[model samples]
Target: MHHFFSMMFSLLAIIGHVSGQPAKGGSERNIDRPYRSELTVSNGMYWGSWGYKSMCPIGRYAAGFSLKVESPVGRDDDTALNGIRLHCIDRSTGSSDSYDYTTIESDVGSWGVWTDIKWCYSGYLTAFQLKVESSQGNGDDTAANNIKFTCTGGYYLQGDGTNWGKWGNWSPTCMGKGICGIKTRIEAPQGKGDDTTLNDVRMFCCD
Candidate 1:
């Protein structure tokens, strides 16, 4: 409901802004949806579903991120990583915190509170690595456990996530400028079995 309202308000805000202004003599809007490259984790785990990709607006790139993490559950079912969010900014402006830029995320599991955001001081996010626990036949299963992102400044940011898996190799760096979109795979609830919500993810790049 919140996401839906946010989208609606954004659309209405754009429409209102345009409608309230007089037409310029010879101005036009240019929409670009250029495809750059998609970054993927080679060893991501299984049994989850993919969601539609959510993208940052044109002229912006992801410079930060946040995670929806469910902390450890004693002996009960555990689903460590639940969702991922990409916070976008126009780095050329040199002010990621001055304005409240748009943020987007793909499908999110119905668990966990979003953690504090992590940001790149001067650049955008470039590459990523996932820590995913493989399935345990009859034991607890937390498919995706944690994540780490590399900033264009040559530093890494780790998530405040659970420790249940090994880290995978970093994904290929963005072929363009930086990451601009995201799509995630999530496992549905299992009534009487282990619940491992987040399984895999893909990051999209933009020029």
Candidate 2:
């Protein structure tokens, strides 16, 4: 009987030890969760553009980019987009110089749903801006009606050009230039319908 009691005590002690302490290694309490933002429109079939612009003191730096767009599935009569194209332009040049051009297609499984777009900068760029556009049938290119941009990683310079500061930490640098930022533009073709309404937009910075 004493041995049986000792075993029960041991089991209880084990249970107490397990419950007394906080979870170890943090336990993935917050990981890989979806981030969200939103854009709204009163018109049903028209195209609208909205975004923010800021000047980052850090001019010459490389950074990562991303964007999430939640768009309602087009009806049977409406023509759906075949793909989305992203353009990174150097605004300082005034010559439409571009750093990167990426296309996200519906088949890539990143569109129609809450689609995410990501890219990395290969060289130092100053005064950078992004443009997202959509394409339909052959010879039909339409700018995204609802778009969002996210800066997930990289260095951003703070302050003005002469008094620049480097923002090494990952933070949302919306519009203009910096770490995490987004600029959205919407364009509707003549016959598609009215302006497109966006359900949501989300941007995030990663560690």
Error of 2 at 207 (Å): 25
Which candidate achieves the best lDDT against the true structure? 1
The TM-scores of all predictions, comma-separated, are 0.83, 0.25
lDDT per residue for candidate 1 within 1-207, as digits (tens), equals 113453355346435534552112222222244649999997788777898787877777878888988777676667889889877778676645436565677777656667888988778899999998887887888889889999987899999989998898999999999998888998766656567888999999988
Q: Tens digit of lDDT per residue, candidate 2, span 1-207?
A: 113343355346435533552122122112222223222222222244332321111222123232333233333222222122222322344312234321111111112322243334332222232222333334323233332223324433221111111212222343333222222333322234432222112232211
Q: Name model 1 segments beyond 4 Å from true.
A: 1-32
Find the 10 residues in a row with the least total lDDT in model 2: 158-167
For candidate 1, what is the lDDT? 0.77
The clash count for each model shown is 0, 17
Worst lDDT window (10 residues) for model 1? 22-31
- Runs with alpha carbons beyond 4 Å of true place in candidate 2: 1-46, 54-62, 70-117, 124-142, 145-182, 186-193, 197-207
User: What's the distance in Å from true for residue 155, model 2?
Assistant: 20
